[model samples]
Target: MSDKITFTLHELVSELDAQADELLKARHGITGSQFIALATLADVEPTDITDLARCLGVTKAAVSKRVPSLVKAGWVTTTHPPGQGRRVLLELTDSARDLVERAGRDLDEQFAALVDHPDASGIDLSALNDHLNTLTAIFRQKGPRA
Candidate 1:
């Protein structure tokens, strides 16, 4: 692709991410980061903040900050796992499952629509995800700047 096309791809991703953050806040009263933490917990095995950070390819501090918001939103609860030596186990609440399911459907619909639209039709969904994964890996290896 040309330089302009590649730049458009990057720009589109960033735009979509901002829009997603707004959508989450409007519909769920939570930020994209918080929703992501909850979604990870809902899908992944019961885990602590550290494991969740690793799973999301984000930092522990990032996940830690979101945990309190999720807890306040009634989407999560944290506790000490049995014999885990103070390891804090996180659980998704019943409300969280409902919220995730509802938001998941909305997000899925929004994504499908975006991908199907003429502006985004050139990119394959799987290819986009693969490229995003590569970007995530690179970021993890190098880390982000302040």
Candidate 2:
């Protein structure tokens, strides 16, 4: 690929991420990483550090490092799994559940607003989703080693 094309994509992604971070920070007073972790926990069953890392596309060590901050905030509770040696299962505190719900609602509204473009044309969302599914399958098979 040409350098210009690659740089354009990178710039676009960086701009998108920066905008998203600003929105979440202004609305929830939380960083995007924290929002992602809370949202993942809200949607999935209580998960261990390893599971959370996979869900967030981060490393287990990174998740482990964040656990203490969450614990201090009373937003998460940890439990040691028997026979798992040192694995800690993370669960959202009840208060965290409420926060997560509120944040999720806000994010949904924000995203809906962005996608509610009056000039949007010829955008088949279902087809886009199907294409994403194909891409995901290809990536899975390639195993990040391609």
Candidate 3:
């Protein structure tokens, strides 16, 4: 393990993302990117593509590209609200809500197993989560770095 905290955080995030992708693929037939987009939409539905892209820390074009597959898979639907002047809003379908809930339960189980393991003994998960959340807030406040 590297002594650099930033490097370790990067590596940990990458590994976690890969594992999540594999798990989601096996259980739900969705990629991690797709899952994230869906989850974000669940948190903030009736949002425009630009807002979704900002939430995902990606480009509007990237979110736009993913919309077709999600629509085809019956996970999302887009609509134009009155007076929006061509602005498109996205929302999760009923099926997508069910899928997100189930997937969230599965991920919770996986996380519980990991935290309950002997190797994780003595770790204060609540504190860790709080610190991570604080860090995330700080980063988000700062926006993207050059």
Best by TM-score: 3
TM-score for model 1?
Answer: 0.73
Write the residue-wise lDDT of candidate 1 on 52-131 in tens digits. Answer: 99888899988888788778878888998788896888899998988888877777678878888888768788787898
The order of the candidates by TM-score, greatest first, is 3, 2, 1
Q: Write the per-residue lDDT of candidate 3 for residues 28-143, one digit (tens) a residue.
A: 99888888899999999989999999999899999999999999999999999999897899999999999999997897688778889898898787788899999999988998
Candidate 1 backbone collisions, by pair: none
**Residue 17 lDDT, candidate 1, scale 0-100:** 79
Q: lDDT tens digits, residues 1-146, model 2?
A: 33695687678567656776787789878777787898898777588999988988999999999999999989999999889898888999998898888877776576556656876555665676698689878977888662
Candidate that would win on lDDT: 3
Is candidate 1 or 3 superior in lDDT? 3
User: Model 3 shows how many backbone clashes?
Assistant: 0
Better of 1 and 2 by TM-score: 2
Per-residue error at 128 for model 1, in Å?
A: 5.1
Error of 1 at 31 (Å): 1.6
